[model samples]
Target: MKGFTLIELLVVVLIIGILSSVALPQYQKAVKKTRLMRLAPLIKAMADAEEAYYLANGQYTPFSSELDISWPDGTLAGAATDDGYLRFSDGTVVDLLSGSSYLTGSASAYVMGKTKEGIYYIHYLDHSSSPGVRSCKGDESLCKSFGGEAFNGGWKIP
Candidate 1:
């Protein structure tokens, strides 16, 4: 009689539980989106560096060392390779898509990363066609959140 009834306390608890249930997933989604957003600028920087390198050398190189990129310490891991591919500490991979076709006129590169949930996000830069084209390849909803348009079984991020 001095305090709230059992039914009243039960209702309050249920309401709080419902609110938390709804909020938790949204919070998780926001965190994931933030992480993905951080990658975009980094990928774009690499693409710009690749373009500059190509202009000077007339061909793209896969190694980041050859490009005018000062990668942050701990950003990259593992030993260097001659194959023109680099791996980031976060498990993302950047590959310079170069070959005879590249020297013939088409020069391009791509950065690909996979989320813990097995979703793949890819950013592609094609100097021959569009110069800087970003693309995504998983979870249509997630891709659309990045302002992507569906194309060829994937989303082209704008």
Candidate 2:
């Protein structure tokens, strides 16, 4: 006799469901931000390895062979194609930057591209390629943030 009516119970359940739907996307975005941040350190590590290889060889070595040294400790949760020159994870392939010293100087070399399930980025290898000044031409805001003779930010790559 004290129990709530079926209509009241259903109304409560519907409210809860509505609340969850609104909150879910925010939670998902937070998760993505955290994941993206974790990748920051990994990116730095890769960059360090590339620099080490540069110091030892005078320039970037072959992208394939040099990748071993480029990411000397790379064991991230991704599939490394010939070391870490190319990293494929969660359906995304992140290619390290290189030049003729790497993959015949193809666009495949000289830049790193990150394509997430919903986002993408094209990273350049030098300041010369910064936005209006480089080969990247999709997102202007992202391009401007990317810089350095040795790096570019993780862009939304195609």
Candidate 3:
């Protein structure tokens, strides 16, 4: 006599479920966006290191002492493996998009994973390409399709 009817209980449960379902995806998206934004500073730092190395060595080296990245040191399965993001020798980190490590390409290009998926690329744009600017590239197909915001003489989210 003091308990709610089955219909009322079911309605309450359904409402809760619906609310949670709607909010969960939105929360996940926000988290992913935060993760993507968090990498911006790291990418910028890598670019700065590359710039400093270029000035000191007269050319960019894959490896730069400017980065104090923590590289793993140890051997696994009788093989020595180092999990270092900075290449300090060639300025490149292999398979950066894979998220196993931060990556750099060519002389002034760096790419890192964004959020739960995709990748963010920061590199120098040649004057012929975008009037010479350091630009960050997001999902390329999205950029081409949606026309991302322009900044620093190039697309900020391209």
Q: In order, what lDDT does every prediction score?
A: 0.64, 0.47, 0.43
Candidate number that wins on lDDT, 2 or 3: 2
**How do the predictions measure up, each by TM-score?**
0.74, 0.57, 0.56
Instruction: Tell me the spans in candidate 3 whose CA falls farther than 4 Å from its real position.
Output: 64-108, 114-116, 121-155
Ten contiguous residues minimizing lDDT sum, candidate 3: 94-103
lDDT digits (tens) for residues 30-124 of candidate 3? 65556555555555555455455545655443443334343345311222123423331213232222221122223334433233355344444
Flag the better candidate by TM-score, 1 or 2: 1
Candidate 1 matches the true fold with a TM-score of 0.74
Candidate 2 per-residue lDDT, tens place, 36-118, comes to 44444444455456545655665554554454443335533544555434554454445564434243223433444353543
Give the winner by lDDT: 1
lDDT of 3: 0.43
Top candidate, metric TM-score:
1
Q: How should the candidates be ordered by lDDT, best one leading?
A: 1, 2, 3
Q: Which stretches of candidate 2 lie over 4 Å from their true place?
A: 67-79, 83-92, 98-118, 121-158
